[model samples]
Target: MESAELRELLTPEGVALLDSLPPYTSSTDVLKIVAGLRKDGYSASLVATVLTQAKLRGKAVAKFGDFAQRMLFTEAGLEQATRLPVAALHAGRYVRAGLTSVADLGCGIGADALAFAGAGLQVHAVDADEVTAAITTYNLSPFPEARVSHGKAEDTDLSDVKSVYLDPARRTSGHTNTNRLANAEDYSPSLDFAFGLAEKLPTGIKLGPGFDRDLIPDTCEAQWISVNGDVVEVGLWFGPLKRDGITRAALVMNAEGLHELTAATDSTDAEVGELGLFLYEPDGAVIRARLIGDLARSIGAHMLDEHIAYMSSDVAVSTPFASTFEVVHEFALDVKVLAKELKSRGIGTLEIKKRGVDIDPAEFRKRLSLSGKNSATLFLTRLGERRVAILAQRL
Candidate 1:
């Protein structure tokens, strides 16, 4: 956001106008709103700013929930900010570790800072963008002890800080619609500088789930966190923040509850065996953390292929770490044969899953000529040396 726009947004008139707006939706008559606001003598810039904020708030519900209504956001900031629930989890770690004074370097829109303050910890939220820092200041206004500063994450003074949390920027610098940066070294604060601080103070670094595990420091705990089945981030914790004997972990959160699988070191992949009565698909975070062996052991499952992440077992095990399906029948990879079988079974609604295969599910679905009232999951994968499709039902 520009300084002029920030000035207007921080004003009482802007605040009241934004608060008065009805909840925004895709169906909202944006043109009507603009005409009405302009007819009321509001400046074009103010109208645009408030409307953008209203729209962003509508989209931010998935991350901030109700708190989004009272917050400000930049396109990039909202997109990059940590989800509120996940930020709370990060704050809980600090509180549990007795690190009450932590610096949040590269704090985007102050999501973590908000959680830190809400958890009753002193927060020092720093960002490279001056406007973002100003907006963060407004967002953290309720907490007198929470400080917001405009500065480089690597250069920020941390003499008084107890612990540190860094979420390096992974996109080109901008307040809106910025392009993503792929190289780890290109991230703001740079991986080198961010990882160097971990050697000194207790620290937690938030990274993309697909970040190179080989690049991870040897001493820190590597934890991949998934929320509602989506692996959101992989956090590396060092020093006092690292859990004892838990260098590798997968934290899965869903309707059932939060489930964690941790190991002191990488787990050996489960031994391969013949496909069994049930197939287990480990959560993405589990696979990312390289803890599939632990999950397999927990559920009495064995790998279906030595190289594949899929596992199976004769016993139907109930666990949140993996989704289980009961096998019905296996068919040769011939599409006509499978289509005939599915049609005969009256299978209409199909949930297609595949691994170790090359086929588009959507295109393949069309070829199935599906027309029925029943639903079933079809797993198209290879077993040993044969390509087969297994019909299964959720257990």
Candidate 2:
């Protein structure tokens, strides 16, 4: 069929087909009709445009469509949601701390709100988009005392809220739309403004994971969260959740089922020395919180250098802050010498890790004639202004 016909078919019949089909993952799948028409030799763009309009209309009426797109078209929605840890890694902490109610401002598709409600907290979820608001209502239907409303966060009365969750819009456009009303600053919504609005109540604001440490305010506690070793989001905590320190790094993992790897300024600070034989790199969350010194002390390790994130140790033990690796072999520098050393050891494959070296890993491997059978981690670094490489394995 032609594109126009295909677009028209999606109005009711197409939606039924979609509902009947197995659940689609990406929101962009809602536009698959254009692709289907194109495969049948129809005008793709024309059909896509019509279908797009119809899809928006359907979303506005029924409150369901591309959630990320709806939020992105308005402002920075995509950037915020993807950057924040939406999987609710810290929900258990929130619940155990006695935070019984949450007002999820700009609750997008109600991902975090649903997590909170499922954790047995009453949720007052709000979104500016009418479609998103309606979707939140439907998405949150199973939760007890979960209420969804349509309005801008600034306009919503929050007197009943004891814990506030903010995931501000951060992307300027959809993949197609380019108009933007605000920049990163606008997406931030001002720490002062957040404190004033949340005032005395616990508040959590989700921010870009890569945001600079300087941007975090002194009054709030900053936490960098990592899930399964990926640095997912940075959370700013206010009121009772705030820690009395510079930053707190939390490595929350599902390993051993579900367990949190928490280390902060209070627990990590120690009188450790310089990097030793065994090198440890703490999780991204711990690094973000600047708890390297504390982590070193906790694990009885020391910093290799002032600039490097690696913590050195002569002994190895399983620790939450860092991954422990064993050093089984050593190689002296001079690319030619290193090549000869590896050859004598019958070593070939290499995993190169760097800290202060300017050497490209590929080039280093090529220079060392690295290619054969054994796999080893090559650490490139500077010890008292001298270039060196350490060969190590998991301890």
User: Considering only N, C-alpha and C atoms within 3 Å, which residue pairs clash in candidate 1?
Assistant: none
User: How well does candidate 1 score on lDDT at residue 266?
Assistant: 91
- In candidate 1 the C-alpha lDDT for residue 158 amounts to 96
Put down candidate 2 lDDT per residue, 74-119, tens digits, no spaces.
Answer: 1222223432234355455578668888888878767677678878
Q: lDDT (0-100) at residue 283 of candidate 1?
A: 92
How would you encode candidate 1's per-residue C-alpha lDDT over 1-395 as one tens digit per residue? Answer: 78899899899999999999999988999999999999999999999999999999999999999999999999999999999999999999999999889999999899999999999999999999999999899889989899999999878999999999999999999998799898999999899998899988999999999998899988999999999989999999998889999999999999877899999999998889988999999999999999998889878899988777899999999999888999999899889999999999999999999989898989999999999999999999999888889899988
Clashes of 2: 7
Instruction: Estimate the lDDT of model 2.
Output: 0.63
- Candidate 2, run of 10 with poorest lDDT: 70-79
Q: How does residue 39 of candidate 2 score in lDDT?
A: 76
TM-score of 2: 0.71
Question: What lDDT score is found at residue 129 in candidate 2?
Answer: 62
Give me the candidate number with maximum lDDT: 1
